[model samples]
Target: MDTIPDNIILHPIGVIRNTTKQPFLVASAAGLTMQGDLAPTMDRVRESEETISEVILKGEFTELLEGIDEYSHIKILYWAHGVPAEGRSLKKVHPMGRPDYPL
Candidate 1:
């Protein structure tokens, strides 16, 4: 059998600063209501980037969200940290998960 490396690596980039108080439970709630004051609230995912606010980026390696507002819309690619290790595994989607179907 091939020997595996004994070392592990870890790096954190930023914090998701939302109006989401109690993110753990609120995020986990099944079909949580976004009515009233919580009507699909909007907030920034704080990062340690030089262009962003300091109160948001409390850690190192957060220089990613800078100048993001210049665009009308921004696409984000990320993994859910709360998901289990097995859940993070890749899966083949139908049509390779393409947005448009073949004519």
Candidate 2:
């Protein structure tokens, strides 16, 4: 396999806007932790269902979204900007911080 370069650059095409101010998962000096239960509560699930989110693209990228309405579903790549530089180096993590799940 080819080795990845140490220096890589990325430009944001758009931003995700949501009502949720704080993140559900947080990475601290100790390790990754959740603000709530390992599994989302019923209320949280309902809140997510009710929440409305939008992807605001940059002016240059706005035209790329044309014809997007024709698709029933689309994929989005999210960037975790809140994570500290060290947190990105984690080799493994339990899915949703659930111990039952293999790392």
Candidate 3:
């Protein structure tokens, strides 16, 4: 009965709360490794083994998740923010200014 046809309301499942002010998190690496200004225009990111995020289900929605633990994997999707206007381009860029890394 709380559903509406014309609108969708998303209650936040969780947040990546952390002290990180710069780019943080990269797969295959441990600990924060932001080399100050390495990618400059782009951004440097690193991931630590520590998990600072949490997912909290609303009290009313908790019952809907009774049998989800059997699943081994899950996916979370979010909109990427903080993109600079100039960062959008159709041109290929040589990653790290190296000719071999054109992308």
Best by lDDT: 2
Give the candidate number with the greatest TM-score: 2
Worst-scoring 10-residue span by lDDT in model 3 = 25-34
RMSD of each: 10.5, 2.4, 9.9
Candidate 2 residue pairs in backbone clash: none
Q: Which ten residues in a row have the lowest lDDT in candidate 1?
A: 24-33
Per-model lDDT: 0.38, 0.75, 0.46
TM-score of 2: 0.78
**TM-score for each model:** 0.32, 0.78, 0.39
Return model 2's CA RMSD, one decimal. Answer: 2.4
Model 1 per-residue lDDT tens digits across residues 1-103: 9999987565544444434433321222222222223222322222212233223443453556678678895544344576455434434322312224331
lDDT of 2 by residue, 45-103 (tens): 56777888898998998888899999998898888887898877777776655556777
Residue 57 of model 3 has an lDDT of 58
Per-residue lDDT value at 59 in model 3:
71
